[model samples]
Structure formats: C-alpha cells, structure tokens
Target chain A: MNSVLPNRAWTFISLLIAMVFLTLQNNSSAAQFLPNWPWLVMMFWVLTTPHKVNIGSAFIVGLLCDSLLAQPIGLFALLFSLSAYFMTTLSAHYKGLPIIQQSLYIGLFYGLFQLCLDVFSYASKPENSLELNLWPVGLVFVFWGAVQYSLERLSRPAPIE
Target chain B: MFNYGIHERIRIKTALASVSAVLLLILDLHFGMMNQARTYLYSITSPIQMVSAQISLQSKNLHQWLLNQEAQEETQAQLESENRMLKAQLLQFNHLKRENKELRALLSVSPSQFATRYRLAQIISIAQGSGQQVTQINKGSQHSIHAGDAVVDTQGLIGQIQHTSLLNSQVILITDPNQMIPVINQRTGLRGVVQGNIKNLKLRFIPQGSDIKTGDVLLTSGLGQHFPEGYPVATVDHITQHNNSEFLTVYAQPIAQLHQSSYVLILEQGAQ
Candidate 1:
C-alpha cells in the first residue's frame, strides 16, 4: 500500500504529461503572457525528485522543446540544465523557506532561464528577439508553489491511526 | 564548507552536465548539426504527444459534461440556431458559385487553375514571443502535410508549415518577424511585400506615390507560390510617409483572427 504513492516511474510520467500540457498551454489565447512551463516544471522535479530529473534528463527535455519549437537546438537544453543544477544544489534551502520566499527564489531562477533564452534569440535572430517580461516568472512560480503544496498533501501516505 | 550534506559526486555530475549542455548549444547554433537528430527523435515523442492530447481532450469533454443542465441547453439552442443560419447561407453560396463558374467560362479561364483542396486541422499549441509566433497542428506528413503548405482559417491567412514530423507540424505565423508574404493592395492592385512586425503587418517597399489608405485591404499576390492568390491578408491601419524618403510606412491589422482561432485549414496546392 505504501508503494502506491508516486514513485520514480509515476513521477516521470507525471512530469511528461505536465510538460506536454504546458506545451499545449502556450496555444491557449489567454496564456500568451505565461512563463515557460517546462523550465519551471524541471526545477520542481529537481527539487522533489532529483534522481528522476537529473541533469541529463533536464537536457533531454530542453532539447525536445527546442526542436518542437523550431528554435536552434540545445538552447533550451543548456538553460534547463543550468536551472536543474541550481535547483538541485539549492532546493534544500528553498524547502526551509516560507511559501512566498520560495516563490521569490523560483522567480529568480526562472528569470535566469528566460534571460538565457532571450540572449540566445538575440544572437540567432537579432530582428526577432523578444522583449523580456519578468512578471510572468513570478506568477508561474507562485502557481507552482500552490501546485506543489497540493501534490504533497495528496501524496503523503495515510498515518497509522 | 563547500557543501551542506549534498553528495560530492552529485556536484561533480551537475558541473559536467552543465558544460556538456553548453557545448551542445554551441555545436547546434554554429553548425546546425543537430537538426536531423532532433527530427528523428520526434518519431519517438509522437506517441507521448498523442497521449497528452487525448488527456487534454477528455478533460475538455469532462468540463462540458459538468456544466449545468440549463447552460448546456442554452448552448445547444445557440448552436442549433447558428446551424440553421449557416444552411440558409449555403444555398445562396451555391448560387454564387454557379454564377462565378459561368463568368470564368465566358472569360475562357479554366476554373481548375483556382481550384484548391484543404484539410482541416486542430491547433495543438502556439509559441508566442515578442517578435516570434509559431503554432503546431495535429496533422503532419502522415496526412500529406508538407513544409511550405499554406495554413489559413475561415477568415484569412494564418501561416505556412515550417517543419513537419510524423503526426505534427510547426507553422510559422504571418506575424512572425521571419515571415514575409507578397501582397497586393486590393484597391489599386499595387504590389508590395507584407512583412511581419512585432505589433502589426508592414507593407514594405511601396513607393511614396503609391495610393494606399488606412483602410485599404491587402491580398496575397501569389508571387512566391507560398500563399495562393487573392486570399485576404490584412487591412491597412496606419500609413506614414517621410517627406524626403522614397518609401511609405504602412501598417495593417491582419484580417485573420491569427491569435484567436482554434481550428485552421491547410491548403494542399494544386490538389483537386
């Protein structure tokens, strides 16, 4: 019964679904201003399931996104790997912080991810580079915190009476 | 201490991976050696994409099922009314079609020259940046979808397919900065290139003497064979002219609901 909760396989599957959902979410008309979900999701997994979402996995996800988006390959991979590394090493500290504070940290890291993407775009297509917006990063991180809280509550094993 | 209970091996591994990612990025950007590898990987990811698509579809269906009975009834009523109106329009449209064919025959022009076939596709995703806009559709090479096929909705041109895999294709929208479509001023038949701008479509290279107004409509001239002729492209919204400059700066709002439509049509050129 204890094994029924989300394990490595379940977590990996969930992350994949989340990544795909996020990809589709970008298609939504109202979600035009949302931050990149795959990056945030990678950071979440790095903090929660480091074994399943290692650096290699992060790079692969980023590479997949780059190809799917038709950008220069490896751009997302590089940024995602950097974010994963940061989250893995610093997530312990983040865990101890309050929810709002954790969101601040997530926003900062997500900003870094966006910054790298913008730099890549500018270099590759100077005329088409997008102006960066940091507000969406904060919004996404706050949403992520809420989602993480809900998942933790749902997945915690029932205590013996 | 350099670490707080974090394993030394993990730290080393992360550093190694980060460096590898940087190397991959440089290789990909400078050499573009990974395009083929990425395309091949899509064959593996298509199944995963299909599963997620089903999940999203089912959830949408579930949401509709959960709607209150009154709301569902009202929606059904609206749809039925809309269907009735469309049926009425269809009869008139058929009459107009016959007249159009007669006129073309009188002019000795073959109607087959203008004939086209379209496949309906669902928009699976849209990636929008400040100056970049790309959309992904569920149809791909499996459905005879090819790169450079024109994509449009009921209203006007949306984009053209940029890349395709087994079951999906990426469309670069008309608003993407990299995208350009040859267009003509429907009013005066003046030819020019409509280029994508971050905010609106720009009709570039038109001489200062060109008679273009704020409300002139633009249609594809079909010069590049990328987009078919006479399809509505945009409506001129703003026109600027410099006293000494040779060209006029004209901006037009796209007539197509580029960012709002959920479904699109992919025109397979020359197909009956």
Candidate 2:
C-alpha cells in the first residue's frame, strides 16, 4: 500500500500537468485555429477512467479554465461537470456501439458546450455580434473522431487478458 | 446485503449532478465571488507563462533580426542621403530663429512643454487557454507596468494590461468581445463606443442620423479614465442603418494588425 503512494502521486501530478497543457492548448487553438473544445478532454478522461474522473474533478478543472480565460466564473465548471456526467451516463448505453457512434455522441456534447459558451457570452453583452459559426463544430467533430479512433485502437485488450 | 436498483442509482446520481451544476452556475453568476480565487489560480500559473513568453520572445527576436538585416542596409543608404538635405533645411530654419524668438517674446508666450515618451518593448507569448483571447507579454508589475496601461504598436492601440505577475502581463486586445473603447469619429467628431467583434472592432451606439460615413478615422475619446486621450484606434469600415432602430450599426477596421503585433509600447502617463 505504501509503495502505491508514489504511483498515485505521479498520476495526480501528471493529470494536473495534462489538464494545464490541455487548457492552454485549447485556448491557444481557439484563438488561432478553432475555438477549443475542452469538453473533449473531459470526455476522454471519463471514457478511460469513469471511476476517477468524476463530476467534482470536472468542476475544478472547469473553474480553473474559467479563471485562466477570464470567463464568467463557474460557467465552464458547470459545463464541464454537466458534460462529464452526461457522457458518463451515456457511455453505459453506448459502450457496445461502433467508434463512429461514440465519436458522434462526444461531438454532440462538445457542441453543446460551445453552444452554452456562445449563449452566455451573447446574453452577457447583447450588442456584441456573437455569430455562431459552424466551423468550430466541424473542427470538434473531426477532432473527436480522430481521438476516439486512436483511443479505441490503443486500448484494445489482448486475447490473453 | 441487498443492493439498490442499478437504474435507480444511476438516476439519483444524474439528478445530483444536475442539481450541483445548477447551483454552481447560480452562485458564480450572482455572487462573482470566484474572481479573487481565479486571480489566485492565475498567479500560480505565472511561472509557466513566463517560461513560454521567454521562448516566444527569443524566436520573435530572431525573426525580426533576419527581416531587419536587409531593411537596415537599404535604410542606411537612404538615411545618408536624407541627412544632407535635413542639414541644409536646419541651416535655413536657424536663420529665422531670431525673428521667431522676438515674436514669441512680444506675445509673452512660453514655449510649449513637451513630455518625453519612452518606448518599453515586450514580446508576446502564446495564449494560455483556448477560450482565453488574451496574450501574455514579457513585461510585468516589476517593470512599472501596471493595470490599465495602454499597449500600442506603430499602427494603433492594441490592448491593455489585464493581469500581471512579476515578469509577465496578459493583454486583452481591443478585438476581444469583452473589450470596449470610447472613440470619436475624427472627421465628424461624432462620439461613440468602439466594441470588439470576432474579427474586427465595431463602433456602437451612433445615432441613425449621425454624420459618420465610410473612410472616417476613429480616435480614442478618453472618456473613461482607463485609456489616455486622442490615440488613433480604428477606421470606419462599414455602416448599416435600419429605419426601426434608434442607432446605426457601424463597423470599423482596426488600424493595427492585432494578430501580428509582436512588440508594443506600454504608455506611462506623466503626473497631471
């Protein structure tokens, strides 16, 4: 049990580091290439470890991102938590589906997250032209498809296992 | 022991999650108490921001050096020719200096005072997150750069300092949706608010009958105590009017290339 401490600590540290990098990458890409879909990271985490990456972790990470981006606080936290919960709940029913189907599910959740951001930002400042361009949605779907395909291939169990 | 129904357990968890999310959203929206916490969290990430900014700075410097090498060679040749012409002009101006001074003394008017403007330069780093539309600059609080300092390039005002750490400050550009600038139409003197759009800045709240037209230059009105007075902000790009609306929807193209401005000046105001 004591020997497991280092492994656990390392895992926690790595997760934090990954979260920061993902948050940074998401924002950078949103400004440069596409609006970031951080929900994809939440989806990936949930699909991999449903037990560890729960609603609370999502909430904290979302809050951190909201702060980093100077977004309305708790907006992302709520979005992330809700997205993770919905994804986790949906995963049980869709676990047997093909990779494309799973990707579609993830893509919809990410789209919803983007929608919430657009709505909130627009509602906050009505005069601002917050046009909802579908390009970011398309980018998110493509990213989700790639990530899901890669993860599915990488996580396939061996016959002996 | 007997187990609870799996469906019931899942539903209960789902309900709980929904409730928590609603509660968090309500709290964040109503209270805004998380701002201090957010600032604290941002401070924690400052080190990573500093390192990234340093790397960006070095790369930008190298790129600038290579570009300047050829430009400088041509500029040096031009300057040598221009220097002779300017020297002759200076000689002619000196000849009239005595007559100008006598006129000045007769009018009992002292010479105009000029404030020295310093150019403090910085390199911009990659934005930290996807949602954040801010850039981190190499200067910070330690450099006498404070919050609300106007950042500009050779073209026009780019942004202002949003957050600062020891050696890094985040600039929220004028093109960000959250940013607003008080501006005046340089030609018509029509004052209005300049707002950031996704791609460019737009002039908001000009009355429908306002004399603002295409090709008018917009300068900072300096109404809000935030930015200084009379700096070029943007040029009127497009104007739209609707009969039903009280105000005209005016859009302006920012004079500065916001995405490409690597070096900027942080203006230091003199004591009034």
Candidate 3:
C-alpha cells in the first residue's frame, strides 16, 4: 500500500503541486536568476496527466501563488490557464520530440511566458516603461532535463505483482 | 456540453478559467474590488512569507560568515554602527537648531516646529525584480499604521506607506519614478524637487548657478506635508549642466539605507 501511493500519479503530482507554495515563498534577492519552478512542474503534469490535472486546478494554484508572491490576484492565474491550454493541446506531439528539440520547444513557450510577466509588470503603472529580460528563459532550458527526469522517475508505474 | 469529447471539454474549461482570471484582474486593478479577499488570503500566506524571509536572511549571513569570518564580522559591525552614527549626527543637528530657536525666541523672533513621534517595524520581504521598488513590513493597519505615512530609517526618509493591510504594508521607496519629494538645500535653503530615475535620485528644476553645489545637504522642506520637516533626505553627490541648458542637473545620494535597513519608522499622520 505504501509503494502504491508513490506510484499513484495523482498522489505524486499533488505533492509536486504542494511544493509550489514553498518554492515561491522562499524567493530571495537572487530569485530573478531562478527559473519559475512551479510553472515547470505544472507544465510537466499538465502535459502528462491532462485528465486528472485540468485547467481549473491550474487556475486555482496560480491564484494561491499570486497570494503568496503578493502579486495581483489573477495575474498568474491568467498566465497559468493560458499555459495549460497550450500544453494540453501540444501534449500529443511533445513526447515524441528528441531531447534537444524538446528543450527548444519548451524554451519557445518559456520565452513567451517571460514576455507576459514583463508586460504585466509594466502595466503595474502605465507610466513606467516596459523592460524585457529573457535570460532566465535559458535557465528553464537548463533545468528542463533534470525536472523532467526526476518527475518521470517519481511517477513511474510499479512493476506487475 | 455533456456530449462534448474529452479534448473539447478541456478546451471549454480553459476558456472559462482564462475569462474568469481576466475579469478578476480587471476588477482588482481598476477598482480594488478584491482587496478584502486578497487581505484574507494574505493572512494565511503571510506567515509563510515571513518564515521564508527569515530563513533566507539567516542563510545569507551564515554563508558570509563561513566564507570570510573576519571580514564578515567587521562588515556586520560597520552596518550595525552606521545607523547609530547617522542617528547621532541628526540628533546633534536638531539640538543646535533647537538652541538657536530658543535664542531667537528670546529676541521675539518666530520659532519653528520639530518632530519626535515614530513607530518601529521590521522588514518582512522586499519585492523582487519589480519596478515598483516596494518593501513589505511586519506592521499594518492593526498597529495603527495607515496609508500615506512617511517612512524613515535611522538615517533619513526612505518612502511613504503606499497602502496597508490588516497584517502587512508596502512602502514605496524614494527611488521609484512615481515618488517625488520636496527638499531644501540645508546649506543655502534652496528648494528643489527630488525625483527617482530607477537607480539615482535627481534634484530637479534647479536653475543654472543656483546656490547648490557638490556635497551640499538636502533636507525635507515640508512643503507637501507628506514628509516630516528637517530630516536629512540626501546629500548632493554630483552636479552637471549642459553648455546651453537652463537648469543645472543635480544628483544626490539618499541618506536612508533604503534597501539595507532592517527596521523603519513610520511618522503617524495624526501625530504631525
């Protein structure tokens, strides 16, 4: 029974979801250099188990993150919902791509995500000019392999009894 | 809706969530319709944020200590004393000014007002990579703190309380473009507006050859009534003028350790 809980996709995925709060809460001055860990974890699960973890859950989790990070209530919710939509639509072809191409694909969307964040930041006060820093997207590509590998191992199904 | 395929169901759900999120964002931004809800949510999450800030600060100090034990110890001492030294200097200035006022009063001259009220609060966490240049504090409306109160450190003025929740508040620092302070040249009593350009504070509209010069001191003019009078705000660090410009470009470094100070004083509105 203990082993079964680890193999249950929903259980493991929820645990990953819980870590999102901790990751965002612990953000420090160097947080700008760090990739958005919660987003990457959400993408992995939404891509793999779209049925169990749907857009609604993504939106709710994003709201919690917004609360924790002291951002506007729905800024991240909007982004997460849009990301879930795109990922759910692309999950079919995403798994077939080679590692390099997969990372590049992730990078493409990650760049888009960073752009949205920057735009929202400017919209904080329209008087402030927009600033675009997409270097952290590179960190997403760097972390892509490790995040994907570990999550896959954690949620791997148990062997036949 | 019930007859839709699985993919179609997911797409519909996504559309609903996106639309809902946009609506929430609009209401929250334009009307602050969600402040009550947001505050309640913050009540639950703020403790976690506080814990994270504590851990990060402790880890940073530990890292510095391990990496350079002697140097870190020296730097810690210097930081601790820096606030005390600035406070002492301001106190001496105030004492002399008060004595001068007393002497003038003896001759039937006008007397000026001075300030003494300040409430202390500890730093919680600073907003990261945001252009707003705001920092959250541990005290809030529950502690009699309210919006628009002028916040200062041991050294000088930092910013004003932009807003307050029941448990936390954010201070908009002097270094944000949106903030402007009225400052007087302590040496010559010349007045100018100090505005922030992201990284530096610029004292604006000083006409060419005004009595201002490099290393001159600037203090609050108390013209706006938002900030307390006579607090050391900044020191003139640089002055430049274009060959044909009508005004001299004056830049001053802020006296308050805006990012470094752990505790801050908020001048209460009613007290003033």
Model 3 misplaced regions, further than 4 Å: A1-29, A60-75, A95-102, A118-134, A152-161, B1-5, B19-44, B64-119, B140-144, B163-168, B202-216, B235-252
Model 2 over residues A1-161: C-alpha lDDT tens digits?
Answer: 12223333433554455445544553344553464534565577676666666676677767766655656666777787777777777766777888677767766766787777777767776766676656666777667767555544544444432
Which of 2 and 3 is the better model by TM-score? 3
Please, what are the lDDT tens digits per residue for candidate 1 over residues A1-161? 23355555545655676667665665565454677766766677788777666787888887777655556556677777777887888867777888888887887877787777677666656765466766677687768777676556544565666
lDDT of 3 by residue, B141-207 (tens): 9998888888999799999887677777778889877789999999998999999755679999999
How large is the interface RMSD of each prediction? Answer: 3.3, 4.4, 3.2
True contacts kept of each: 0.39, 0.28, 0.46
Model 2 alpha-carbon drift over 4 Å, by segment:
A1-38, A87-108, A111-161, B1-38, B51-133, B176-180, B184-212, B238-250, B269-272
For model 1, residues B1-272, the per-residue Cα lDDT tens digits are 45545467666776777777777767765685765675575555666566656666787789988988999999899999999999999899778878978998999986623436889998766665432477778899999998888999989999898778888877888987678999998989999999887557888999997888989999998887788887899999999989988999899999999877878999996554
**Model 3 CAPRI rating:** acceptable
Please list the C-alpha lDDT of all candidates, in the order they appear.
0.76, 0.68, 0.78
Say which prediction, candidate 1 or candidate 2, comes out ahead on DockQ: 1
TM-score of each: 0.75, 0.66, 0.72
CAPRI quality level assigned to candidate 1 from its DockQ score: acceptable
Clashing residue pairs in candidate 3 are none
| Model 2 TM | 0.66
